[model samples]
Target: MDGLPMGRRAFSSTSPSFRATARVGVAATGVALALLLVVAASGCEPVPDGTPYDLVLAEGQVMDPESGLDAVRWVGIRDGRIATISQIPLAGADTLDAAGLVVGPGYIDLHAHGQDEENHRLFALNGVTTALEMEVGTAEVDEWYREREGQARLNHGVSVGHLGVRIAFYDDPSDFLPSGPGGYAVATDEELDTIRSHVRRGLEEGALGVGMGIQYTPGATRWEVLEVFREAATHQAPVFAHVRGFGVEEPGGSVEAFLEVMGAAALTGAPLHIAHLNSMSLEETPRTLQMFEEALERGLDISAEAYPYSAGLTSIQSALLDRYETAPDTALERLQWAATGEWLDRESFNRYREEGGAVVLHLNTPEMEALAIEHPFTAIASDGRIRDGVGHPRTAGTYARVLGHYVRERGKLSLMDALRKMALIPAERLQEWSPDFRDRGRVREGAWADLAVFDPETVEDRATYAEPALPAVGFHHVLVNGIPVVRDGGVVEGVAPGTGIRAGSWSPGS
Candidate 1:
């Protein structure tokens, strides 16, 4: 009995009380010793002497991917941070019965484009606590942060995008993504200097990092991209890039496009994050992933993200589809007009290209998607955006889809691994430059109380191409900064607890 098995030891024995008792060399009497043994056997941390916690989640499977913690514990939240995690129940002013639920760090979307109230509400239902516009970030970093300062429902941030800068530089006719001169005009030496100035200014204004939609701005020369990478490096910022090409079209295919950014990263020591590796790599996902892995092994500070989806959404007018005219009729047929959910032919494709809007391209195969998603190096990000409830399913379903389809149904990876991709990995990607991320993406004490409590059995995405705005199901409660944004499986209206998540090193004046 004295040498009880490790597995049978009390879970609460890891509590601060046990450590305190050990350090103080306290001896216990028969009754006191029995109480101590029972408490240890019960796995509840010895209740510290303190006022009751502000809120407590009781009897839940708390999963923290950072520490590989998977156990039933009571989580105590106070003043927007986790105060304690105990195996035994603790007193709280407010408590939620979290029985049969998994309480974990809220998901973080590093590539979310929809930062408005509408999208934030959906993001909450999807268990996303922080939604970042990293792939096609805003040109107006200050304005972007200011707009969402107190209006957003979930934590938000943005990157300063090269596409936005280029669009403004050329006075592009289209919004969001360039369709006119911004897409096609090659920059002169002076023009490059002007673009570089705007990029530097954006970073100075406290952008999370630089966003480069390389495919959208085909006119940007390799040297011009290298120049932008230099600017990001100057500020110790990462470059989140949509690599220049898609598919295996030789010359400028996915392999070469990946190399371009990796090369820039190597030359300038700029950290790089490739956006939507599944969409960017297309048919060559495996090869590009290998390349990404090799580059990481070579000591490059680089990472990639992918959503659990096959089709990708982008503006039909983007340079990405400039080749649509020459693309086989079969290819054109696969482009689904988001407005009507109708497949487009050459005529429809051209018509939509002239009248720019979102188009859902059914591009990659399921096999290819599974490959990218299952890879260990990739983080889970929703390169998702919705405007007036009219966007890709990914805008709403990305996270839940991963939890439901990939983790639960297919068993491609472990649930802990999925949480790591959604939470810890994304945070770690930015933590080097943004110390604010240091406390995020974990369920440990002193971490921000951004928690997502959901029923793993029924948790799933409900959004589809035909109904892209449908909110995901299974999340019972979502807390942002210890405030419930989603309660009882619905969005809690009239509350805006979201804050701007920005880099720690540089502020407005610094």
Candidate 2:
């Protein structure tokens, strides 16, 4: 490992992580030794008359990021929920041989942008069971939510872009329409009422909340954001923000500046999720972590996401990327399509900047890059945008790289710690918007059979900056709903009888 650092206790030096882990007794598996006791949660048992599950994943190695459990065990699954998890083996008609492999819940992606046919397969390849798109980039938020749910191989979730709601409602990117006591901006207060009605309608239509890209739309007023956040907060949905100045290096342009957006959430008591905080901080990695920590200490419910790749994927067409293009470094040179080996040259870059490629930025600091996984508020996201319709590395490389670099090679964090960020924490965060978020982040019996099996020693991310198309190695089996999607380094086509999941249509309080 070229850039491996110290304090990394989880890497397996002698063999694949799974083999090394297997040789050691339950006592020495690092944090992996602690999560063996996944007792049934209180008050979360089967209903009085509900039918039991269809399958059970018996004893192997169960890793629950929430409780930080990492040990060899057995799990029982019934009717798509976790039944019982213990060293005591229970009877089951079906079982999986997860011996010598890491078995944890499938990942919950907080801010994946693209959802294509191949990318769905690519996400399946990486063991991502649920993904929520924050910004409704190309499709209508209503249709996009229903569309992916209708066809995905993995369970999918969505956030209605405030930008989408704005554009869709206003249907015009014009100057001020009305705002003050007497003046109306979008139109009369009656029309403003109608727009607010539309935004609420999107939330009711199943958008998790709103996605705000403020820098991209400078014309959007703060009241506009507050207007919808109040509504989403009422519905118990958090606002997902791609805060104004992202991936920029200037005054008020860093990741820290985005905390102001987070502050707004805190002010209104709305849950806020910062989009790709890691992508914006290559040089100020320490400061960014501190800022997020301080906000958490302030009692703000804020979380963030990052991709494993130092570089992020987006088109140059983003309005915010254009404002920062005054420098040569910031100028779009060429965006090498990850899906295709072909290159979109500098000329194309400018054209796309105008036409909208929102070119992906490559993050290069080893420390800041490592922070993507090490930071507390941060979770893994691919920022995977749909290109004519193929997948990107983040879809295939994130978890594998989380294993290979942070835990296996670099030793920045423990394996269980990484799983917490990749699985449990994201699941908890999702729970704010979706009930399954709480249920899915662990490996108890009867939970969604979304599981990933891998040999720690050999499990490494193979995708590179140049070879971004290659899928990583080491995952032996991946199951969704008790159906094997990946078995022994091979993917089973058409077995993708996987269904989509919609969350929080029912409010606990309201």
Candidate 3:
């Protein structure tokens, strides 16, 4: 052990199992030893696999979510953190031949809804290692978080919904019915204070941020909202807003509602984020972006997120023409375009309609949909949901669809840009949670080795609204904390290697 590396080094006697796992090439052991020794002498930190290497993804189109690089490179992983990502022969481990694949920091989704295990499984198959669940409507959020732990394969995070907070902790229980009559009883300041207190407690307990379905609670006066957001802003948290109305339903469409969120930010001096812009921004994506750009220039902390699909999801109850305006079926049909009728499987819709929700689709313009994805400031989120025993297509198709349609076929965005939106932007937004997650949205020497490997040229999204359960094509390997979740297109099921991400900002009025 004299003059050895600070970390244990393989000397052919490290343990039969460890040796077997390394699978180091016989002839190059000397070269690997040399590189390991040099790195050790320079005080470089050790890799995950203490015995040297377990996996090395070699010579592939490496895409670092933060660096935004797509090139032929070798990424060596020991325990978990990528030890070396070099163009040279970064040795060790059983080689994962990614010669023609697109390698990326595992896709990160900042906005998503409830799609059950079936869809969660599909998400991993498609290479999304992390998903942030920002919907707060299901008031049973605390319990929801409890149930998902050690249960779902993908990494998950949650947000406290403003509307949910009001309904759950402050509202008179009986009044929590469907949106109707263009009005619902608004929460009084006394009631709002109680709800805000509940929200603050949830956020302090690691909830990501505030989620407001402003679309449902239009009666929530701006004053009450500013009170809530100002609280979030004190913690530098971003507020995710579900605008006052779906595009077609609103008098001025998506822009007016988005403008409302921005206006709130301006008034409250709080950061704001528009959720699922693809579904809501319709003919407004371009113009909305122009407004966003102005906000950015003015140094307003504002942004928007969207999924890759053109059709959006929601309850059939949301169709403005069907519920609010009573427009022609054709107009409602246009809005229905984006909603995934697949989940509404005639049976569930019938049940939900008979019992409560009337979930349906809202069709989106292909052009505007494309524009939303290509926008640099817009982060790519699945806005995915769990449904039935499976999940919505966004659970599985989002990242792959972006690669297939946006990067490969449509040429709407470069591979690098897409990866950044998937990982970096979401990661940046996640910083409000904790310092650990702050600078963690990248692929670097000391960063997490959570990785996704696919072939850009061959990567294709197989999940669709009609067939939302299809597994995506082209991910050959996926690693979470350096543990293999998916290896060669198959789930290594029984390993609970992922850790729950925790939120840290909590100083009351900070």
Candidate 4:
């Protein structure tokens, strides 16, 4: 209730004939009044005075990276949208004292693999409002969206995944990624047509985009990948891809794999998003970033994301680790069994490969990871997943780790820039394809009232590799669809305000 009031500019006086100046002033006032009336008729009028807002966050350091707003302000939410942003206080049905806290747009994770209740809670606790499974998305796109509607804690969506379609086609026993014939069996021309049809159907069902895990489906030919890209292009859908291979080892290395997909995007004119640029490139992260920058300069619709961590996680049975059968002990020791947090030897690696479980690979260096995270163009995303408290730490820790360690502790990037990477960049990447995202990722009036309020000095990730489920600390409040899912550092009980996000054109079950 203690702040400066909003003010309007005052008209200046000049030397002129009194009658002429009076006439000009009166005419100007008439035009302005006409314009104001027109605006009010068009439903652009300001909120009526003395009418209480649904919710108000008072005296927070409001930061909107898009508009470069960094000052204390009061925010009023009404009907799940930000209705007022005032320099002074606002009255509301419910009010939160946000003094000394940073109120920014809730983070958006473009590569989230955790969409279940457990992970959604973690994401909300960590200040993420929308967590999308874009890397390896669902095969039954409509069913996937339907299952989460009104049940999820955070906004959710999925792509129509190439990996899932291939696995389903081959009847592969693996659930998440291809491990058997799906990985090794090549598709015939007719089979390729069937795959393209499924991709097209998913788009028609309102999938976020085409999700491709080419590395997991090794048998998918270059031509097959291109045809899928073409299908996505026809729908004006972007392709979120895990390139075909990893490492800088020559021949079937990261360079070759990246070029293959880059070529696909170029040939078909499909927008491309490179998933987890840090993990996929490892030591070659800088080089890959350069390639991405150059491609952007050449008018390619390309973007990349990275989590703030030095390790990666995946199923031991994935085709990505097929060479581990012949790999030396040195290479095998880099893996840590996610179930028990024990380092793996050749014997343990082989045993886990047969047993089929998640394995954490200590593959990247801190320096290389920092390079990707610190890049201006790279968005922050948690390519994260966990089940029953057993998985990598990135799922629970990514955003906070970036804020606490990268921005606050190390001074790697400004707070605004960090928020931009976490919120705005990811939203912009998908807004072109999905109308659900157009007003997201900002703190402006009329934007969605999805917000994260946190104590900048105290916020930090508590989740560790050994204890992966530990929720982050110092998030004072998180709101989804203008409802508080987290308040005063704890999750609000029994609330499910999240809704399914899809492409603009498709309706439910259409």
Candidate 5:
């Protein structure tokens, strides 16, 4: 392939010089030397001159929130890593002309639950490069990673879930979102030890961190929670949690839930990540952000994330709806059936609660949702999951919605700021757990080539409550590991370059 171009080589046995060389005793050697010289000269011939890359995105407005770089530039990718970012042209096997588009790191979803192929496709179309199961993570972390190997469309990872381990320890029948003994019964001292052992084993086996859905497992005592935190601290893994409760109402309220996790973080010295703070705090989201800021100020490694939507999704069988039996009106008023898209009244709520299905609660106001999203410290994460094809629009549209509504339409956030929340912040949060994340979430050279290219003026989410599977628009291309998973505004078929992102491969300081 490196030989001189076809029909361009100067070789002719009938020529006078060739004939002269043939007449000599060392004709073969002389001709070979001539050919070598010609080949060397051909190496200097003008071919495609720029540095060769596997892929090149040309003339795009590149943005890197971490470095605060936003400029029109050419980006080159080779061997699944960013090879160059230059003002000059680049040569590649494939080139995507990204004129008038914004090129940035692909969104990383820290609290995502949809790790299956279908949801991954949706996530790719929405410009998410990594989708993790951090809230209700798996019991068998090794099995989960193995099953998705060579099959996923986006980078994926999971936490060693407290709820899943508890269910497994108690032989509970639930597969996800505890409902039976795991949700309602306090564990014995021996049972707690078993659960802790399982969590530690999972972390050792490359689970991203410990996932605790304290709200799902109300029966989990403070001691059990503390034990999980201690295990997390030992492994230097952050704990991703849906706190113990929600709403501003007393007894067991959202404030108390926040305090529980905060105290655990303080006591056990475990990093804490609060999930879906907008939904959890609802009207009190501003206050919650203030608390998170204060926690940061106090030298606590605490962070939080929120989706753009004003609703939250969960299983009806989970303990989150346990209050519905008595105070049905307030709960039912905010609840909507995910499958049928119907606003749940007392009658419908009761039926679904017994039958067991996913429900969306309109627990947050639009103002509060926006406030949480605009919070400087809050990252954007989709608490996204899908069943069959029915689920929250956030499963397909969270990142795009932020770019579209929050940044472009409403001007609530700068484009760079939104990208920061979606990309750099999430990567920063998990880089301590896995060194693989270090090169992610940036557009500079030597970074992993996970990128999203979209029209800044046109990018927006179209998914809605009635039809939640709709993919976002205006994303010209989305690449995972420098492979185009989405091209020309559609998901490419039969390409899966995604790899499992695991922890424990490196220590925090390393």
Candidate 6:
């Protein structure tokens, strides 16, 4: 409490001196009455005694990128919102001494694929408060929200996915994404109408937006994709897309895919988001980002995001992998089996393709990943999914990796810039569709008290591709709606304070 500004102290009614003064005033009412009348005329109100908050994070380096605030301060929380931020010490029922820690808004992962309890626990340990499946979203928004109502560890939501709709219509027995006939076959006119109806219904039922994985559904015609964009435009919702192709190999390259989505945004006037631009564009990332900048300057609402790792993950049965079958030996060398840590040759690639599983493609280089991360317009997202405790390291490590490697160690990005990408940018992207997002992703008074406190020098991601389920290291405290789900570097047992996030309506509980 040293070097802290003093707040107005409340008079102690129980003190012996105060009692003596009261007795004297009662004995000399004439003089005391005049003094009391003068005091009342001054219009000063008495301060009430006791702690003012339920929780206080004291003396932390509070950083809020949205407000451009970065300094040591005290944060007071009461009834699930930030009540005050002060230069003085605050009294509370509980005080966490965070003298050397960085207090910032909790990270929001917009393209998270893992929306279950196990992954939520890991995400909390890494300081993420909201995780949404906006790339390959749910088929039934109602059922998805219902299932995770009181069971989630962090805020969760989904968009209505074109791939999920395709699977549902074709009756494909795929869990994570569509494959086989649903992924490869073009829809008939009746089926297309049914898809449109489902998309519209999902919007009505409170989906965040429309999700389309054009690369996964290669058979979806340009006209069909545009119709989906138009449906989203009708509701004024954004479209999150994994565009049609990958790499810089002309004709049907990543540039063409970027143009296709940008054109849809221009034609339909719907906001568009490109998923994993680094992995999609590869060596052409610089040129691709230039195109995005140009489109943005032209008044088109287009944005892009990327993960920190050099590799990307997907099902072995996906169309992108099928295209790689005819690719060169170098392409096969880039394929890393998820179950085992071995890089694939042509023989191993064929074997895994037949067996059907997830694979990590080492398609992007470190330089390319850095380029995407350093871009001012690009946001950060973990296109991560976890199943049976075996998945990509991005599931547990994306945000921490950005903080640790990009900001702390390499100095490629400043701390404020990294935080903006992880938290503020993602929240801003979704706030138009969901008003609940307006209160998140900031460490300011009156904002929702979802925050992360960590040691700037020590934060690091411990998860690796070989052992992908390990939680991160330096998140000391994480709060959701002013409730601690993580404290002292571990998850607090029996505390599930997270609520479901929905569009066009506030969630029922914090």
Best by lDDT: 4
4 or 6, greater by TM-score? 4
Per-residue C-alpha lDDT of model 2 across residues 1-510, encoded as one tens digit per residue: 111121132353543454444445444543532432322223334322443234445445677766656766656666556666645433455666666677888877776665666665566666677766764432254566555554566667766665555555555432111112111133445655665676676676666667776655555556666665676677767777776664455654666456667657876777877777776665766777788888888888888877776676654444545544555543444345444444555565555556433344554466678876677558877766444434456766777888787787776677777777877877777676777665676776546777777766677776665555467788777777666677777777776545555457833233
Q: Regarding lDDT, does 4 or 6 come out ahead?
A: 4
TM-score of each: 0.91, 0.81, 0.81, 0.91, 0.89, 0.89
RMSD of each: 6.4, 7.0, 8.6, 9.0, 13.0, 9.9
**Tens-digit lDDT string for candidate 6 (1-510):** 221111111022243332243244344444434443122111222112443578888767778888777766668888888888865456667878776677899998889898887888889888998889998998898889999888787888899999999888888768767777668888888888999999988877788989999988888999899999999998889999999987888777989999999999999999999998988899999989999899989999888899999998999988877687777877687788998888998888888888889998888899989999889889999887778878999989998898888886777577777888999998899889898888999888899999998876678998899988999888999998898889988898887778788886534442
Clash pairs (backbone) in predicted model 5:
none
TM-score of 6: 0.89
- Candidate 6 runs further than 4 Å off: 1-51, 505-510
lDDT of 3 by residue, 337-379 (tens): 2233433333444345444432435567778888888888899
What lDDT does the true structure give each of the candidates? 0.85, 0.62, 0.65, 0.85, 0.83, 0.82
lDDT of model number 4:
0.85
Off by over 4 Å in 5: 1-51, 506-510
Residue 171 local lDDT, model 1:
97
What does candidate 2 score on TM?
A: 0.81
Off by over 4 Å in 2: 1-10, 14-59, 88-91, 137-142, 148-150, 170-194, 247-252, 333-348, 354-358, 386-392, 507-510
lDDT of 4 at 350: 81
Worst 10 residues of 3 by lDDT: 1-10
> Residue 130, candidate 3: how far off, in angstroms?
0.9
